[model samples]
Target: MNAKSLVVIGIFGIATPALAAAPTIDQLIANPPLLNAEMDRCKHLGMAANDDPRCQTAWKAENKRFFGNGVRYSPEPVNIFRNTPDKLVPAEKQQPIPPAPAGAPHG
Candidate 1:
C-alpha cells in the first residue's frame, strides 16, 4: 500500500473507537437539547400550552425523568430540640420553688 493509503487507514483506525463510543439516539434524547427544545416550544405556546396534549406529555415526561413524582415541602419549621428530652419544655412553664418550711433556722 502507498504511504497515503497507510496514513488514511491509521486515521480511521483511531477514529473508529470514538465514533463507536458516541451516545445512541435514546441516550441523546435524554440529554438537554431535545428536552429543552420541547420545553421551549411548550413555553412559546403560552396559556394554551397547558391544554396541549403534546406539551403536557412532554412536561410530565421531563418531570418524571428529572424529579420523579414531585417534591414535598413541610409547612412547619423543624424543631432543633426534638430529640432532646430535657429541653422539650420551656423554662417559663416549670413550677416555681416553694418557700422554706416555717423559717427553719434562717441561714
Candidate 2:
C-alpha cells in the first residue's frame, strides 16, 4: 500500500476508539434503566438519603443529567439583597441625617 494510504488507515484506527467510546444521543435517550435504577436506590434510602453521601451524589448527578446545567426557575423572586442588613431595614427606620448648620452652604 502507498504511504498516504497507510497514514490514512493509521489515523482512522486512532480515531475509531474515541468515536466508539462516546455515547450517541440515541443511546443516551434509550438508557432509562440507569435513571430508573438510581431513582429506586434513592427511594429505598428514603429520608436517610439526605445523610448518605453516595445517594446524595447520585441524586445530584441524576438531577443534572435530566435538568441540565441551566438556570433554575423559582416561584418566588430571589432577593439579591437578602444578606444586606441595610436593604432589609427601611431607610425611614434608620437614624435621620442631622440637618446642616443654619446658613451653611447647601453645596
Candidate 3:
C-alpha cells in the first residue's frame, strides 16, 4: 500500500474502535440528556464518574457476559451502564392516573 494510504488506515483503525466501544454515563452526561443504560455498573459498583474508562470496559464485559455477545445495545443504551438493575428507572417511570375528587370511589 502507498505511504499515504497506510497512514490513513492506521489512524482510522485506532479511531474506529474508540467510537464503536460502549460509551460511559459520564460521557453521555457530559452532553445533553439522551439515551439511558439498563445497568450502570460503574455507579452500582461504587466507582466515580472520573473512572469512566474502567466503567466502559466493565460495562461491555458484563453486558456480553450476561446477555451473550452482541447484546450490548439495550433499549436504553447508556442508562444500562449507569444505573442499578432493580432501580434502572426510565423516564416513563410513573403512569398518570386520574386524581379522585371528594367522595370519589375509595377517595
The models' CA-based lDDT, in order, is: 0.70, 0.66, 0.58
TM-score of 3: 0.22
Per-model TM values vs. the true structure: 0.38, 0.33, 0.22
Lowest lDDT block of 10, candidate 1: 19-28
For residue 19, what is the lDDT in candidate 1? 37
In order of TM-score, best first, we have 1, 2, 3
Q: Please tell me which model should have the higher TM-score, number 1 or number 3.
A: 1
lDDT of 2 by residue, 1-107 (tens): 99999999999998777543433334443566755665687789889878866565566656667887677887777667766664454455668799986896678
lDDT at 82 for candidate 1?
67
Predicted candidate 1 versus true structure: per-residue lDDT over 39-71, tens digit per residue: 788899999999877677677667667665554
Flag regions of model 3 displaced more than 4 Å: 1-41, 44-51, 70-107
lDDT of 3 by residue, 64-86 (tens): 54565464467854654544685
lDDT of 1 at 71: 48
Collision pairs in model 2: none
What are the runs in model 2 whose C-alpha is more than 4 Å off? 1-32, 71-107
Spell out the clash pairs found in candidate 1.
Answer: none
